[model samples]
Target: MMSDQPNLVTTCTFKGKEYLVKMNIISGNSLEMSVTDKYTTEEWQCCYDANYIENITHKTGNFKQFDIFTTMLKSGLLKTSECVSLDLLTYDDLEMLRNRRMNGRNLCPSHSVHTNNVNSTSNRRYLILTYSVEFDRIHYPLPMEYCGPPDPQVLQGIIHRLEGEVERLQEQLKKQAEQYPTNNTSHISKLQKRIEDLSAENKTLSEDVRYLNKALSKHSNSMRHIGMMKGIVNSLQEQVIRDRMTSHRQIKRLQEEKAVLKQQHTSSETSCSKCSKDCFSISDSKCLLFTTKFSSLL
Candidate 1:
């Protein structure tokens, strides 16, 4: 129901029992009924006697106008803005309301009352008057049939069963959570220890790499120094070979000069002996000539 007006959920107390109901607009009218609960997955369908709906409607002035669930809502009981601030329907009010409207042939299929007994003449004529959707106003109608009231005691039993189920579910959840608490905590701690060990190993590997790099650099410098020394040694060896060859040439030249000096001394001595012999022969010839001249003078 589209309306700017606020809906009201009002509760009425009766006979120390509780029921929940809502008042909301449906098709431009107010509807008040027992609160709808979530459907159960179980194979059982919940049911209430039709007589209960008639008797309660006979008592409360509300929901008298419409017989069906939809019509009652359209009657506009919840249209009043005051309903917004009002509290939810009291359990008493909801029980009474449910007692009146929820059990008609429209909602429940198994009604046992005679059709003629439904809305009898005595039940009519001001049995209960409440707002009706018929003329968009209040309506008065008589009770038609009786499906017999709900056994309040049986309803209480159902509530008790539901409460027990809820308790069992809660206990199971608690036990399961307790069982694995330590296992989860220990698994997390082990993972943390493994991570720490891996980090330490990585640090050690990095240090080793740095040390190897330094050693390689020193070996490279030593190789370069050795290469330079080898070149210097090669140059010194070449210079020594050149000096030895020069000394050998000088010694050969000196030997040749000494042999020439010896040959010149021998030639000069032969020439001196030949000159003395010639002088002696000339003196003999002079003496012979002097003797001839002296004999002629005598």
Candidate 2:
């Protein structure tokens, strides 16, 4: 539900123009605010949720339209004005207006509808029909002060002050122009000297960088050569290991063959000695037989 009466009514200056601001509390504790220009009668309205207002108050939200309002509210620039509340009579009139239609499109007049018959001198007014973006129709009375144009005297005074400010700025500029040449010459010289020094330093740094790059290249080549040498050394070490293993196996086989040859030679010598002894005994037996036969024949 929304309230018929405005919660707050205040006068504030927005964008250098005086405006009448009205705030109403709507459903879910949201705020519906309307701002009407005092001179132009132009109106702008916006609805802010409770969380949105909280964020704006906490400086976390950045709504350009309402940021100035929040600032003015905090700075006491929004002067609170008395709001004419809706009475029973005014409520009945609003109900009737809601039903009544001027055309087929349900258009309402901008003027207020008063039910009471009061004296002509009584300047008290009631609801004025207005339109808002959030609501189709809003009943709020415009303040009397906001209905007319701005004071000419105030505008003239502002113009006069601005003219004086312009003259003062022009004088300041003229004085600066008079003094600029000497200051600029010295500043330019100093800048040129600084630039020359920087250039020299940059040149030195460039040379140093080039030297470091060349040294790095040489070191890289040396590292690659060292890696190649390491690979060659590893290959030679492996070949030496294989040669030593082969030589050890060959030595073991030769030793085994020599031992077998020595055993065979010892057996052959023993057999030869036994055969010679047998030959000598046979020859002696044959000679004795021959001598016995000759003696018998004689």
Candidate 3:
């Protein structure tokens, strides 16, 4: 029974002071009270012993919502056309008249529908709602004397409309959540890991570029030194070749001078040999006379 009932909130006047009434679930005619806001938890106060909230009484002894609505409906006071047809009342007056006539239910109105076929009853308002809606009054054949609140079928329709609204809102929320997917820790971790890997790779590439630049500089220096050495070697080779040519010319001139000296010596030796031959040809007989004359001439 409690599950079928919705918590109700409404304004009530107690001792000329407006207070809020929260019609909480009850057990065996006990009316529960909420003190979370207005009173301390230690107090835990309850004010009524009525089995049903519709039977609750206020300090002012004002008629309960059920009694008021029934009275107004019976008296034709709730018919808007009838209320407005009063020639003296303006629009504002009509609005106030309507509000006054409503008298608003003190507790959320819970009702049941009686099915004739099954002879069973079902709770009309099952959802946990705290408010009521303004439904269009339907024309129903009655005794011409406005009876109590209309048929349970009308309340059931309002309940169905409220339930439909709740369902639609729930579906829309589900669709919205599905449209924007959630981010899990693992996905975030994966992104962070990828970023870290890229950073490391970039650092390694930077180091490699640094090393390459240094190597290039060193290689360039080595190439310059090699070029200088090649130039020196080429100059040295050219100087050595000139010195060799000069030495070769000196050797050729010495060989030519030696040949000329040999030729002069050979001529002198030939002349000496001829003179010796002639001396031998003069014999000893003429030699003695010739030696005496030659000795005198000498």
Q: Tens-digit lDDT track for model 2 on 209-254?
A: 3333333344676445434433433443343344334334444544
Instruction: Score residue 30 of candidate 1 by CA lDDT.
Output: 31
**Which parts of model 3 are misplaced by more than 4 Å?**
1-218, 282-285, 288-298
Top model by lDDT, which number?
2
Which should have the higher TM-score, number 1 or number 3?
Answer: 1
TM-score of 2: 0.24
Residue 56 in candidate 3 has what lDDT? Answer: 30
**lDDT of all predictions:** 0.37, 0.43, 0.35
Q: What is the lDDT of residue 188 in candidate 3?
A: 32
All candidates: TM-score: 0.24, 0.24, 0.23
**What would the per-residue lDDT of candidate 3 be over residues 1-298, giving only the tens digit for each residue?**
1122324433333234333223344453443432111121111123344423344323223334543422332333222334211011223333344455455743432222222412321211111111222543321111111122222233334334434533443354345335523323343344334434333433332332333333334467644543443343344334334433443444454467668878989999999998887777766657888889988987
Q: lDDT of candidate 3 vs native?
A: 0.35
lDDT of 1 at 187: 39
Per-residue lDDT, model 1, residue 117, is 39
Determine the backbone clash count of candidate 3.
0
